[model samples]
Target: MHELSICQSIVDSILEELSALDPKPKRLISARIVVGEFRQIVPDFMKEAYKAVTKGTDVEGSELEVKTAPIQGKCGDCGWAGDLPMGDFKCQSCGSSGLKLDGGMSLYLDNLEIEK
Candidate 1:
């Protein structure tokens, strides 16, 4: 699935960053990632893909810590700001349909733990 490609991208980015290190890292220990709910990335599947791609590589066996951020919404009618349920943007207050999605649509690497 797309997770494979995503994992590949993660590996490429990790490698790129590692290459820039002054005393290059000997291995990666962990990777902290943030995947928004809107992205619909399955943590288990992504982890499997990462393990598969990292097999026999320097990052192999490294842990992946995924943090989830809720989808936030802002009501255009009542100016209410809060978390919103996935797939729908109904405002909690005033029951207004004019709700604008705020965040929770990102997938990025937060931090990486490396060994020297």
Candidate 2:
């Protein structure tokens, strides 16, 4: 699944960042990730992928916390700004399809807890 590749990328980044530290962490404790609704990433699948990928790594047994952000957009025609359902870019107030997405469709590591 794509989640496997995504987890691998996350692990690679974590390792690279850890190596750059002055002393480097002995082990990773947990990780916090922010995912937008538009990203469509299944949290359970991601957790499973992470567990499988991290199996023999320093981050093994580490907790993964995922936070989801709502999809936000602004209507270009009526200046309506608010949350919207995923994939529905239409403005609720003005019934306009001309909308500008402001948030969602984002995935990023928020924080890492490590032990020295």
Candidate 3:
């Protein structure tokens, strides 16, 4: 699944970041992440991906915790703001298809638990 690649990227970036630490971490315990609903990520799939990709690596056995945010949109013309259904970008109240997505398009590792 595509989540495998995403998890792999996370591991790679985290390794890069950890290299900057004054004393390198000995083992990774968990990774906390914020994934937006607009990204269409399945949490179960992502967890599976993390398990598979972390095998034989320093991050093996690390837990993946994901927090999801809603797909929010803001109407430019009528100032309407609320959650929007995926694939339907139109403004709910104004019915004006002119809406801008304010958030909910992110997938990033927020924090990591590690042991020295």
Query: Local distance difference test, per candidate?
Result: 0.85, 0.86, 0.85
Q: Give the top-scoring candidate (TM-score).
A: 1
Residue pairs clashing in model 2 are: none
For model 2, residues 57-101, the per-residue Cα lDDT tens digits are 877899888889888989889899999987678998998999888
Model 2 worst lDDT window (10 residues)? 13-22
Candidate 2 error regions (>4 Å): none
Q: Could you report the Cα RMSD, in angstroms, for every candidate shown?
A: 1.4, 1.5, 1.8
**Candidate 3 wrong stretches, greater than 4 Å:** none
Worst ten-residue run, lDDT, model 1? 99-108
- Summarize candidate 1's per-residue lDDT along 27-68 as a digit string, tens digits: 889998888888888999989888899888777899878888
Local lDDT at 91 for model 3? 92
lDDT of 3: 0.85
